[model samples]
Target: MKKIILLSFLAIICSTTGCKKFLDKVPSSFVAPENYFNNEKEVNTALNGVYDILSREQTFGGQLPIRHAVSTDESFFSYASFPTGPFYYNFGADDATIRDLWRYLYDGIERANVLLANLDKANMDEGKKSVVKGETLFLRAFYYFILVQNWGGVPLKLTPTTSINNVNIPRNSVKEVYDQILKDMVEAEGLVKKISDIGFGGRVSKSAVRGILARVCLNMAGYPLNDVAKFKDAATWAAKVNEYGEHALNPDYSQVFINLCKDQYDIKESIFEAELYGSNSDAFREGGRIGNENGVKCSASTDLIPTVGFAYGFVSTTRKLYTSYEYNATDASKRDLRRDWAIATYTLNASGVKANIAATNIYARNCAKWRREYEVVTPKNKNYTSTNFQILRYADVLLMLAEAENEVNNGPNATAVNALNEVRRRGYGKLLAGATNPANADYPGAISLSKAAFLKVIQDERARELCFEGLRKSDLIRWGIFVNTMQATATEFTTYAAMTTTIYKNARDAAQRVTATHLLYPIPILEMSLNKAMVQNEGY
Candidate 1:
């Protein structure tokens, strides 16, 4: 079935140019719905089209993650010569990146809608049909989730866009959009298969639906919605995944990426990921670009060789992120293993020797999680890579469970503490003997804190764990600290400016531009120009 799906996908891509011929013909040239979704194979082929949107550069491929990281304090453009205006929040309705993202998300939603509207009409097994319908619902809901979070309220185009009249639809309320998302998720949870049945993290499963539900519930429980009651629901959904027992944290965090780079999917740790198939030809560019955007620039032939000169030293880790790891009080050797693995503290010099980043060269602190060197086949073009971008991991599930538990109970409980400890234990390498070592070990012990204190801890923990993965901005927004955090980051940049030349000066200036108005990006100018009923977000 997988092979059939892959072949059908390639066929669709190869035949895409057929649309140009349709432009020259009359209305009769279009394929009718009855002719398209006729059987199981046709429906499956359509389903593959929906999945393909996720791999686009505007979606998970590049812009989405890059903009998310640069918009926050998690990362910065290493060189002032590179485009840094967007990182400084200088972009507005005319921004190309924002426009591309908006279009890509709606495109995904539309593809899902086309599949869903005709799913029941297809000739397929009852169980298989249900799986297809459920996957479409999950994909559509996921697209809306991203839209609502970024744009606040957007047009809720649920049905397949079959006519020109549907193009003028108005924007819905954030609450209305979220309501639809939760509805689809609830239905999807019951219809999707278990992870054991699929045997791959790329496909939607019941546990993935639950995990996303927990994430959605958390968003509702915060900022815009402020529905405190939803915290219990979040906890419930997260606990379900925790008890599912199919997913577990890989003991070695570094190995997870190594496996992904090798195109070896680990369903145990990565509950869901955007699949990227590498290729050496420009004609079939399907690989990921995260490695090129994040890896450090070096002149030596070491494990961390520089790829594209432009992107080689493009994105740099922020000082705040570099210092997020925990250190042993007495033992210098005992530190959070993820620190060096996740971020580059040093790089190979021209002599192939490790060189620590000095005050004069802060760009050396590049992100290492998506290193291109680990790829099984080195990409012919540095802009493309084979590494998969994880969407949801078991560690994220455990952390969400901890957060929701604390929010609902007004303090941490044994269940919540245990979940938090599990992640920390793995981060410290999960050694029973080392667990007791005060010098270098796991979480010191169970945490006891008030509601406010525990919530703060969870926020900090999330930044430390998920730093370059594109969740920081949304996390900060939900906590109602987006503006304040950026303001504080600006002050931190000033201190950093004192140690460097004009490079740090430009960064400090950009960081200072973050304000309350930036809480939600302006509704793209193009979108507003097209829809008369569409209103721009406040302070745009």
Candidate 2:
């Protein structure tokens, strides 16, 4: 229940002053489990190390979200020459980003393993010990989930790697890995505290465990697994979180993000997020990246300057996403309020003047979710803003419940319809009284639909609501439309290229690059080389 000072704790865990290569399996000499985890303070310190990895530039801090956004129809890099080859689906075994992502995830898993293996030795209170155990289990399951989703069956390391011999463990089957994830989450559900008791969304809680279980079950129900019965399980788990009643949608969609920038954790909406803090200098001194990667490009100091200035144009919303915003059929004046807040139509020039992007410039739109201007305290450096990266939210729970309910029942039921409408009501800025004027009336109420029709509507609604939040590609993959969607986007790019020479010619080429094999990333070249037992994914 206490606020952990992450920076100071990171200093304790990473005190050993050696820079090892990213994939090197050498253990740090200073904080080895034999020397650390001897006391309650030490065990808590080790847990901080697990949380620290989530802030790394290669993982949640930047690359992971950027990769997910650009690889899908939700976004793309602005410049033709931007080094986004992997995101374009053009990279192979030697891609450094993919390799870094693999290493970072495994590194976190290693920390969690060490903590779990030695927690019993620490002289902590029994209640606190259970909380720590639950958190570590959740963290380990989370890392494995990301690995299984991206790389398929990876080496499942359940224990601490005490020596070099244990490092070369072979990859496990996808089902085996998922089985462990589900097992860990189910155990975590009972051990962790409720969200209200924890008072912050950053820590793992009962609601967080249920929320992740719902997500994993949904994945099991779709795509390669096609375990249709899991749809009922997914809906049941998501509904449990709703029934808990500790989380709900924030009235103004924009304020949710504004609150995040100001370090006001919204337990009612943001269920879980990777906590980030300090200025750019703080990140540099502490060996961490400050904020998320998505933002507008700006020249001078403005409210958007701190967060958006560091944005390298590596990812921006696509035209497909821009046009997905729905409007009230009866009242032409009303439109989805999420459109402008999620995507920037204009940017500030060098002199701090607003400049409209040309209509033909398809790549100019930037994600506005990480605005720095809303921070109560100005950032010390442009690169580091204290905006936490939202991982799970209550809106997602409602939508997932709706989708799974439809899939299980073969039509939209009363429960599914109400859940779906609650999200829509908030999106139209009508959930909170006085949040919107009469001009923005309640979202033309929910409609009745069959299974097929409702599923299509939910897919489009997710795109409109959660675009640029790093979940788009996986959503498409689960729906069995990833390849088809990419091919269709490529066709659209080809037409845009004909109309304007500024657009990257290869944009169309890359859009068509996704194949069945491209669905999972190939084993990183370093991993394959280091562990001969590790086999590469199909198609290079």
Candidate 3:
């Protein structure tokens, strides 16, 4: 379906933007917007174009999911020796990766604007049209949310940019951008289809909008904005999803990701994901590096591709993440199942056998959540795997609700504790819908913890459950502890790392480089040059 849409989009692009028809008078000229978007097909094509940006390499396709989100306490670049890069955080605004991410996100916004601006011209079923409009609005707001979260305040471009000359827009305040996001997303919730109606997690659904809205509110309630009122709003939105009665945690914790690797949608658990397809063994080049870049290390020359697809294994888990999962210091039976699944315990060797990583070397394990071994698309490309990267999940929604509820009520109410316990029960592999697991109690004595201690539990729970799914850095930033956390991580590396190991120096250096300035990425140098009213982020 994605391939067909993308191919159609390419055809439309060619027809409208100067692909030649040799028999025509103006063979390679432009087709004005007035002539296009006269039918539902045309408008749908344009909408798919906007959705395409979400899977671009600069966005969820790779950098944002891996490099941009890692280097935090959860994980780090396996090859961190590079002194300056997104992973190292020692780059300037002129850095190409930063500029590319900024451009891609804005490109998504612009595409959404173009579709929405011209949507009314199409003669389609009004209901279908409204859903399309709702999707576009949600996407535009989401693009802005990413911008605001990363750069603090960015130029809010709403209307379509019809010309190249209009480039000097002023930046909006963070509050203003967030307000616009809430307004658009709230309206979108009313217009978009429900997850059950959609039958998949790839496209925008009411639950997706509400879940992300809750996330946005949670962000506002923290860090720079510090809008405590938003906590209630966040809880309200999350409760809507929880109470929707359709979604639930997939019984097996690891199977949740395994389903993603196999391109199967468990809409019950995965609320939304970037639809990644095709291995590029054919003409469709839309696949992503979700598993390949972050999968267990496998060499093309040594490991047989047919047995275990090649993965550069560029990203690895931190000791902090390995230790974050609940486990008794001496007993193995008290272990959390999420730890081994989240962090690989073995790597494939030259003969394609499992080379188990020693228990002592926790930091050496790769992120195992998105393993490529289960990828069903055969003849897989070494650089790309057809693994759909989940953006929102029911477990995450539960955690968000618990966090926000705790904040709003000044303690963990029954609802909050139960919501949190659902996730904890799943982690211990004891959550069967109606069955009792007397052997593994839910949180043991969670109810007795004070508000402060419960908040700490929520924080650790999020890391243990959702590490390397690309929320850790933003999570730390919102908690107003990114710098302190990274600095402490550096101390840990200094304390635990062998003095002679390269990881000791590199990991410590990367962590130490983080400072107040890293709270938000810089406004791209290209944007600064074009928009005279734009200001660079502090210390950039």
Candidate 4:
């Protein structure tokens, strides 16, 4: 199918890079500022260029999605162009992508600055200029957030077109960068009006800014080890998003994932999404990274899901998680229809659930999360036609709100509980799009969960709700229990019965426990080759 999509958005005083590989010696190709700001359209096109670069495989369209490679078992030595190879090695603090992330992001920074610097001269309506400014500020902060999260401290670039030559800039502490991020996003939060702009999917939005701010705060609260202040900040930002009232969870949870679903742009659940639409009819790529599997088999049958060996591996779920399904699943009323449809497992069929299908051809117990698509142009290529990557779902925001609020013990607060309940309600075929009391809370010695219990609930909910959406590993990291959980999950793969479970352990850990350093990926090799001044992190 020829999927039609256009990505652009509302803006006020906003605006927005690349060079030949050899000519890259210059920090940037300076176009005369006079000629640069020739028209409002010129500035708009400049920002479009930013979107263009980000959509490249090197950034979001392809390579960035593989971020799960380091976290999941669904990967192996890519016979193809492997962009994230360094991550698996536990590459140093200064790898190229790390540095390229610096450069690519700065490239965005300069573009945003250009717009902000020239906002006054723009010929567009004054209202439009403010919208543009809001967008630019959001983009700027968004890029910096990516930087600080990945590289810790990075030199801040507010608006330095005067000296593109300043390559010797020392790194700013992570805290400083975060401060800037907060400042810019805060401004963005105010300036962006509700959008009716064309092509808004994946474009920045008011709620998107709030969601990122909340997420950033949440990360800061947890990363580098949990800080009480960070938690407070996290809660505050999350609350800001909820309080601001720009979004809500859709009534249906599965509606969030199905490619065929409409109102995708209108779905209250999508705070932000990556827009992917392809209508190519080309032959399988020869030299270039065409469809961006990065030369690796993504969710390869044996690698990610459905492999008995991989299933039983420690990465597999414990009987604990499986039990969560037992509690929440609708299969008891026609069991397999609910759980069976979510995760693809080999089992025989029964009323409430399907028994594990007995078939050797069964690749593994895998998540049905992947959107398997058929080829359009070239018959050989298999594509996942889903246009929207649910990067930040509205339900997640609600649950996050619930977590932050509940942590303070203020209340499961009606609204917060509503948000959490909404997810389960949709999943279990209920109307209420919020959390509810577990049926017979005291029944049959229920798994007692205190405040911490919600954490596990969220984590398992991630498994059931997100699954193969390229989030589990990061969730594992953020939940702050990758090593223990992943290790136990890994060892579970050792037994015959466990093969269907994700119990396999990654050998990288030798029992001393994986360090927080593992969370930050090393900069790419290319970046180190380019910037000698860039310091490498210990243990490449």
Give me the candidate number with maximum TM-score.
Answer: 3
1 versus 3: better TM-score goes to:
3
What global local distance difference test value does model 2 have? 0.75
lDDT (0 to 1) per candidate: 0.72, 0.75, 0.82, 0.49
What ranges in model 1 sit over 4 Å off? 1-30, 82-85, 280-283, 298-311, 328-333, 348-363, 431-446, 498-503
lDDT of candidate 4 over 445-504, digit per residue (tens): 212346676555656665655544445555566567756664563343343232332212
Q: Which ranking of candidates, highest TM-score first?
A: 3, 2, 1, 4
**Ranked candidates, highest lDDT first:** 3, 2, 1, 4
Among all windows of 10 consecutive residues in model 3, the one with the lowest summed lDDT is 18-27
Which ten residues in a row are the worst by lDDT in model 4? 307-316
What is the lDDT for 480 in model 1? Answer: 92
> Candidate 4 — what's its lDDT?
0.49
Model 1 residue 446 CA deviation (Å) reads 4.7
For every candidate in turn, the CA RMSD to the true structure comes to 4.1, 3.3, 4.1, 7.5
Q: Write the per-residue lDDT of candidate 2 for residues 289-393, one digit (tens) a residue.
A: 322356665565556454444444456776788777865658644767888788876776756566888866655677877665565544435555556777889
Better of 1 and 3 by lDDT: 3
